[model samples]
Structures are given as structure tokens and as C-alpha cells.
Target: MTVPDSLADADGLATFAVATVLGFEDFGADAVVEAVRKSLPELADEYGEQVFAQLSSALRGAEGDGASPWSRRTRWPSLEDRVQRMERVEYAQLCRVRDALTLLVEASPALALARRAGVENSDVRHIEAVRALNRRTDEYLRRAEAVSRYPAERAWKGFTGLLLHVCSSPGRLSTFQQDVTVLDPALNDVPGLGRRVLARCMAASDGEA
Candidate 1:
């Protein structure tokens, strides 16, 4: 089903490979093949486990030498090759994080808050470090604002504006540990805000409301 990366595309071969690798004895290969044919374009170059998960099926199918199309799936094991691939994946993750942080910085209250908090030299230096990673975020925001004509667009000359603000020091990170985490399930795993208590601490700084 995959656009015949090679000439010997065989029916059910891709699916059969998947089922065998999955250890499903009677899994129908034809069904899997159709699904792969429809989805391979998106999944083919996907990162990390996604690629290997799909490969598992093809790998299973290829176990027995045959004209099966699954036999044609790519294989990789060289240490140097894996290292390069890992670097690309890490690069992508970094971009996503930087973009999200930039998006946060471009918002107003966060900017005002950071500006007020970042008066000192130490704070100024920390903000600079964070900005180094946010160059792309500025670009995305510009394109977004130009198309939509939002007021925030007027504020952000570039990502550096946001980066410089966020790079300011976090105001002496507390070393004390606390059990408090998230009260809301939706916000779990979010970084930087290490604990839910930071919200309460911020509220106290602002005086009740």
C-alpha cells in the first residue's frame, strides 16, 4: 500500500509483517495492509517509537523470505546512524518548547509581570539566557499577527522581545521541597512551574486578588 517505494508491493504483506511482529496469530494481513497504505505517507518518517512500532509489523512479515512487500521496509542499527537521528529528534523537541515559551512571553500580563520582576542585574542576565532559544517563536508570532491583525502583533518586534523578558531571573529559585503538585489533572507534566504552589505564591505577591 505504501507508494511502492520499490516495485514488489505485495498484498497483505505489510499487514502480515505487522501482525507477526505483534505476536497475533490469526491477525488479518489484508486489513493491516489497507490501513498502512492509507496512513504510511504520514507515518513513514515519523520519529522514535512511531517508526519502530510500524516497522515491527513489517519486520515480522520479513522474517520469512518471500515476495511480501513488507520485506522492503527500511532497516537501521548502525550506532552512528542512530546518533544522528537522535540529534534531529532532539532538535525538533527543542524548537517546539522554544515556540511555546515564546508564545507565553508575547502575552501582556506575563510581560508586565516579568518587567516588574526583572529590575536587577542578575535577573536581567537569566532572561538573556532563555531568549537565546526563542528566535523561532518570534517569527511564528509575526506571521500569525500579520494575517489576523492582533494588537499583540504590534507589541512583538521579534522573538527577542519576548526572549529578553523571559530570560530575566526567576527571582531566586527556592531550594525547599514540597509535596504540592498540580490540583488540576490537565496541567500535569508542564515544566518550569515545578509545583502548583507557585500559583498561590504569585497570588500572595499580588495581595489576595
Candidate 2:
């Protein structure tokens, strides 16, 4: 399954963020917002003022009984909305947005945590560990994408089990602890990369999370 490109600069990023936040069942708006900001810094750098302003405005609107993206009666912007927004952006801006989106999607939280722990990709142990995590993550994502053709219940069970395995794998956790003082370096600073991956999965499966 092919993932659609993020092409509308801050507008596109903001839309994706809204969709993602809702996709997670709006787990915690504050937490989700911070994670979205941290994970996609390029959006901030490029259009920090407007992007954040839009995000703030959206949040303010989501308060109390106000309809939010998560509300069934108030669905998030559609593909057409995104396309229209993208069409309004300059070509250069769109290019930058595309690049930023690519980085955001490619970033791996496990790798980020490893970097924070000072584990260089140069070391064989570090390389292997990183490769292992990446390979496993990719495998699951690919399977998730392909399994869309299957019935909903079967697909959900398969993805659920896959997520549980990935989240609880002792060997994977142990590798992350190797040569690192912090057991989980990203706990304080960065958002869980796994959360981002799951968010993408949720989006692909139409908010299944």
C-alpha cells in the first residue's frame, strides 16, 4: 500500500496532526500536541507562527462541548481540503513541506533514543540493534498495509498482536539498554517513535487505533 505524500506545508502538517490526534482517540491533547510539535520541527521552523496559531485555534475550538476533529459530526478536513490547501502554497514551500514530512515519517524514536544515549551508528552493536528495530518496525508496517485487503476483524487482531509483540519484546528492550546509562532516554524529551508509527497506522486504517 502506498502512503500519500504530505504536500501542503504547515496546512498539510496541521491537518495530519489533527487527524492523528483524533486517531489516537484524542488520548491526551496536551501530550499529543507536544509530540506533534517535537516530531515535526521543520513545520515549526518554516511556518511556526501560523502553524502553531492554527493549532492553538483548533485546540481552543475543541474545548467543552465544541465540535472537534474527533467528533463524528465534525470530521477532520477531507482530502479535498488538503488538496485545496496545498494548491494555495507556493511551489518552493510545498517542496520544503514535502521534505519535512519525509523526515518526520522516516524518523525512528528508537534510533532517536539511541542517539540521545550516545550510541553511534558506527559501532557494530549499535548498528545491529538499530537495524533489528527498524527491520521489525518496517515488517509490521508492510504487513499492516497489505492486510487491509483482509476482513476487518482478522486485520485488527493481526495488527493488535503485532503491536503487542513489538511493544513487549524483551530482546528489543534489552538491546536498547546496551551501553546506555538511560534505560529510556526519550521518556523525558522526545515523543515515543512507536506512537508516531502507530498513528500512521491508525490513519492508514481510517482511525482504527
Residues 1-209 of candidate 2: C-alpha lDDT, one tens digit per residue:
23422333354455556756455335444544555564454344333345655665565456544456344332344557545644655675445433322232233344444444444322324334443555433343344444444577885675554433322333332332231222123322224444543444455568444
Query: How many residue pairs clash (N, CA or C atoms closer than 3 angstroms) in each of the candidate models, in the order given?
Result: 6, 0
lDDT of 2: 0.42
**Whole-model Cα lDDT per candidate?**
0.39, 0.42
Worst 10 residues of 1 by lDDT: 171-180
Alpha-carbon RMSD, each predicted model: 19.3, 18.0
TM-score of 2: 0.24
Best by lDDT: 2
Clashes of 1: 6
